[model samples]
Target: MWKFTLRRILIMIPQIILLSILIFILAKMMPGDALTGMIDPNVSPERLEELREKLGWNDPWHIQYADWVGGLVQGDFGQSFRFKMPVTELIGERIVNSFWLSVATLIFTYLIAIPLGILSGRYNDSLLDQTITGYTYLGFATPLFIFALVMLWVFGFMLGWFPTSGSVSPGSEPGTFAYVMSKINHLILPAIAMALIATVNTVQYLRSEIIDTKQKDFILTARAKGASESRVYNRHILRNSLLPIAAFFGYEITFLIGGTIFVETIYNYPGMGLLFFESITLRDYSVVTAVVLLFGVAAILGALLSDIILSLVDPRIRIK
Candidate 1:
């Protein structure tokens, strides 16, 4: 397992390099001068030219790329013109909120999705199974923004059960139970909206796994030994069915992080998603690149964690 993990991490080096290059290309494709993103808007041409000279803007493309990568290695993301602050500092603050929201969203996603999947699969074509199937399709079909809007309207305004936007109420007191509840309350609506959308894949995937595993020879052997239905389910069928779900978690995690951006935007929540959207609209290239890099890193880490989890749960996977 250790060897496999080390190999995977080693493999990630080239992927991260490729990701950085892709980000650089995308940033370069944006309209306007890169120098504009690094300077104050009201600066005179003289100052701009001075900065251009100082930063070696006249250097060859490869030299410039090397400089940028070197700066990145040293944790020196350029200043955000819009925020008037270091891009890393801005991302550092926002990423925490995104992390917590993602945690809440995944908690809701798996807790709700797993049970529905098992029930639907166990019951096969019964009414309960059909109902879950229909709902999963609805989730897959409904646009995220539309669903978020309706959730805001119905749950936020009509029922007044959740705060419509933001990470917490304006006056929320830190280090208090009320503050904690406020945070959780703010997360609930958006988390559920994202969860419902996220759960479709898990539910369908797990459901299919359960059904397929149920017909296997191993499952039959377990039953023939007079293993109780509950015992066979817990030990044989469900355990086997779960391996695929565990393996698929990396893809699900990447989707959740990416999808959270729109949900955060709609809710006006302070997170990487919202920050990424705002930075792009404001054309804050430094902040945009930082957020994109963090996102890529998050995706890579999520995949690595998924593999680790799969290996822990099934030794055969690690051995292979």
Candidate 2:
């Protein structure tokens, strides 16, 4: 396990390096200049040149990328063009919001998906199974932004049950329970949007695994031994069947980060998604590159964590 883990970490080094290079090239290739968003009509050409020089934008692309990579190694993510703050600080402030939203979405999806999947699998071909199948199809078919809009209209516009946007109510002091809960209230729409898209695939994967497990010889043996139905299903079947679901959970987390980009834009929530959107609009290369790298690291780490968990659970996955 240690060897495998070390190997995975080693592999990630080049992956990160490649991602950095790609982001650098992409940022450079983007049509607009970073200073385009910052410059005003009144700003003179000399002043703009001075600003570009100050930002090191006058340097060759390779030199800039090298400096950026070096600073990244030292934990300096560079300053944001839009916010005029360190990119790390900008990302840090928004990460918790994104993290909590993702957590909420995960909890919501898993709580509903696992049971629905189990029931669908256990009663395969029955009406209940058909119903779950229909639901899953509906979830998978609907686009995330559309779902978000519908949810916002129903929950926020018509019912007035939750706030439509923002992380927290403005002017609310941090660290207060009310403030935290209020932020969670704003999160509901986006969370549901995220969960709906995720739940469809999770249900399909889990249900397929459970149904397959049910037909295995060991399951038949357990039944022949006069094992209780619940024991056969939950203890033997679910225990083994959950391996795929466990793997899917990690993949789902990575997917959620990507989905959050669209969800956040629709709802105007202050998270990494919103930051990424803003960075693109403002041509904030530092912020854009930092966010891409951050998400890339998160995805790699999530996969690594999942592999470790799988190795622990299934003896077939040898340590070495």
Candidate 3:
């Protein structure tokens, strides 16, 4: 297991490096540079050139990339042209908001998906199964941003049950119960948007896997041995069935991060997604590159974690 884990971690290094190269290239190839967006139309050409030089736009692409990567290694993510702050600081604040939203969405998704999937699988071809299937299709068909907007209208505008946007209510003291409750209220629309988007697909995938496992020879043997139905399903089938779902978890996390961009924007939640969006609109290359690299590293780590989890769950996967 140690050897497997070490190998997975080693593999992530090259993946992160390659992702950095791609992001750097894409940022450079964009139609404008940071200076282009920063300069006023009436600014003299000489002043614009001075600003460009100050921002290192005068350097060769390779030189700039090397400096950027070097700074990255030293934990200096540079400054955001738009926000006039260190990219790291901006991202750090947003990370908390994004983390809460993602964690809540994850918990909600699994809570609603796993048990419902298990039940649907156990009662396959029944009315309950069909109903779940229908709901899953509906979820799959709907666009997440649209769902967020509609939810905002119903829950925020019409019912006035939750705040329309933002991470907390204005003037709410931080770290108090009131502040926490305000955060939760702000999270409701986006969380529901994320949950409704994820639950259907995850439940359907789990349902299929569980159903397949239930029909396996080992499951039949367990049943024939006079095991209780719950025991057979939970102890035997669920354990084996989780392998595929576990493998997919890492990919799903990355997808959730990307999906959060749209949902966060729609709900006006201050998160990495919103920051990334603002960075791009303002041509804040440093912020863009840092956020992309951060997300890439997250994806690589997630994959490594998934591999370790799979090995822990089933010893057969351990490296020799």
State which candidate has the highest lDDT.
2
Instruction: Note the residue pairs that clash in candidate 3.
Output: none
Error of 1 at 315 (Å): 5.5
On residues 118-224, what C-alpha lDDT tens digit does candidate 1 reach at each position?
Answer: 99989999999999999999998999889988998999999999998899888879999999999999999999989989999999999998999999999999899
List the global CA lDDT of all models.
Answer: 0.86, 0.87, 0.85
lDDT of 3 by residue, 287-314 (tens): 9989888888887887787778878877
Q: How much does candidate 2 score in TM-score? A: 0.95
CA RMSD (A), model 1: 2.6
TM-score of 3: 0.94
- lDDT at position 102, candidate 3: 88
Which ten contiguous residues of candidate 3 have the minimum total lDDT? 32-41
List all candidate RMSDs to the true structure.
2.6, 1.6, 1.8
Q: After superposition, how far is residue 71 of candidate 1 from its true place, in Å?
A: 2.1
Estimate, for each residue in 1-320, the C-alpha lDDT of model 2 and write its tens digit: 78877887888788878888998888888886777845578988788889889888889999999999999989999988679899989999999999999999999899888999998988999999999999999997888888888988898899998898898998989899998888888897789878977898888888899989999999999999999999998799898888667866667769887888988988999999999999998888789989988888888778877887777677578455
Model 1: residues with Cα > 4 Å off, grouped in runs: 33-58, 311-320
lDDT of 1: 0.86
A best-first ranking of the candidates according to their TM-score comes to 2, 3, 1
Question: What TM-score, over all chains together, does every model reach?
Answer: 0.90, 0.95, 0.94
Which TM-score value belongs to model 1? 0.90
Find the candidate with the highest TM-score and give its number.
Answer: 2
Query: How many backbone overlaps does candidate 2 show?
Result: 1
lDDT of 3: 0.85
